[model samples]
Target: MAKQERAVRTRKALITAAAEVFSREGYRTASLTVISRLAGVSSGALHFHFPTKSALALAVEEAAADRLRVIVERCEKFEQPEGPIRLVVDASYQVVEQLAADPVLRAGFELGGHTVEMGSSGRVCDLWQRWVASVLEHAQGAGGLRSEVVPGHVAGLVVAVTAGLEELGRRDPRWLAHPTLTTFWRLVLPQVAPAGTSVPLQFAGS
Candidate 1:
């Protein structure tokens, strides 16, 4: 049991170290030597856990996907009462918060942009985009969206805007801050929500 627990810890450490290196240096340039050293593990341990850089990156992205799902699920559980638009707005804020605070998620999102280099087909952005689209479709059926609003269009816009914010936030943390998303939601919610619906126009806590 103790050996298994230590192995788990070693794997997590390697993933975290890989995420940090990948986040800073990007996938093509990130070095396994640096990742293993940063993880305080030997090269053999890293190899034992992840065989190759692509495998390590995949692990990082998978970890990020898990975190993203948790954030979405959490927002859905508490923010649904306010309506779909509210849920989206809150979820966006939470995502940005996680992006700001979690290197694994940030690395996953960044690595998603370099799928060609990694030869990986999955993208974290695509996952988020599909989720947004599905939720908006639900909103349309529930009469929460404006009569003329197309859920796909709204989802596209939302996903694009958030993707831009994520890219910009990579260089400037201010881009990921709460006020930035609040301002975006403020401008967009009015256009998306049905006429005269009393949707709350603030972040989850504020």
Candidate 2:
């Protein structure tokens, strides 16, 4: 039990250190030596936990993807059809906010290596897209969205908009915190929400 606990702690430390280094130096430039120094571990110890830089990058991406999944899961609690769309917008903003707030996320972005792969990161994004698509499909079934717009297409649009917003936030951290985020949500919500459904401004209150 003690050995397992120690292993967990060491892994956490390595991940935290990696995040810091990756965010400051970027993935390609970040070296295991820097990660080891930041982690307060010997190079050998860091290598023991993560065999290669790519492995460490994968771990960071996995951690970021997990955080994203949690945000999407929370949206499932909303009872209204429009709730999902609202949740998507809110969640997207939250992701941006988190990127600024959490070094792990920031580092992952800084390190271009933190992308989703076919079996790992790709699966995560696919799952999230499916969740968003499910919500959009539900809205369409309830006559909340335009029948002409396919759920899959809407999902793609949402993902694209989210990527754009992320880039915007990266360029200007203030973008996520600005009132304009709510306005952006409002503009996009209409295109997905069921007809006659009112779009709420929950983030504006925040």
Candidate 3:
């Protein structure tokens, strides 16, 4: 393989290995030696791709962010005839499902909260909040929000609830299930969606 292609594979391998270690052992305890061993790459090769454990963690977090962006974008494609509120709900549900299945994404969120040890990768939870707020703001601009509802407040609530679910999922895998998220949206949609608008108990494309 060419140097560039080799580098790409090495980097991907390192990130994947890092995700497994971080998810299984967490930021403080996960070792680069184990990560290199898991990737079946030499220590030099791991260093060539990620010079430090923090660098590898950052890479994993970046990949997770990209995955989340894809999730939200996918929700945009299947726009419900109902409103933007439904779009946000579906998007949030998709993220929960993705988090449950994808250990990499889950690890990204895990490492994100470990900023004290992981350097300055920033909080993935903050990214999640901003994304939720942006989606809710779109709904507000489209007049889909309830007359009494504040878009920012609702967005914060969504972030807290989803984060709580993700945290719970760390302990009990069932917290990441479809019914768990659907139950959340089922309660949220009725309050946020315009009065008399029949928000489905189950989200579309669930």
For TM-score, the strongest prediction is 1
Candidate number with the higher lDDT (1 or 3): 1
Against the true structure, candidate 3 reaches a TM-score of 0.89
Indicate which candidate wins on lDDT.
1
Q: Report the C-alpha lDDT of model 3 over 1-206, residue by residue, as the tens digit.
A: 69889888888888888888888888889998999999989998888777877788888988888888888888888869777887777777788888888877888788777654666545667788888888788888888888788888988998787778877898899898778777777777788888788766454444
In model 1, the worst 10-residue window by lDDT is: 197-206
- lDDT for residue 69 in candidate 1, whole number 0-100: 94
- Model 2 alpha-carbon drift over 4 Å, by segment: 81-83, 107-126
For model 1, residues 114-149, the per-residue Cα lDDT tens digits are 664777666788888889999988888889998899
Error in Å for residue 126 of model 2: 4.1
lDDT of 2 at 204: 72
RMSD (Å) per prediction: 1.9, 2.8, 2.3
In terms of lDDT, the poorest run of 10 residues in model 3 is 197-206
* Deviation (Å) of 10 in candidate 2: 1.4
Ordered by TM-score, highest first, the candidates read 1, 3, 2
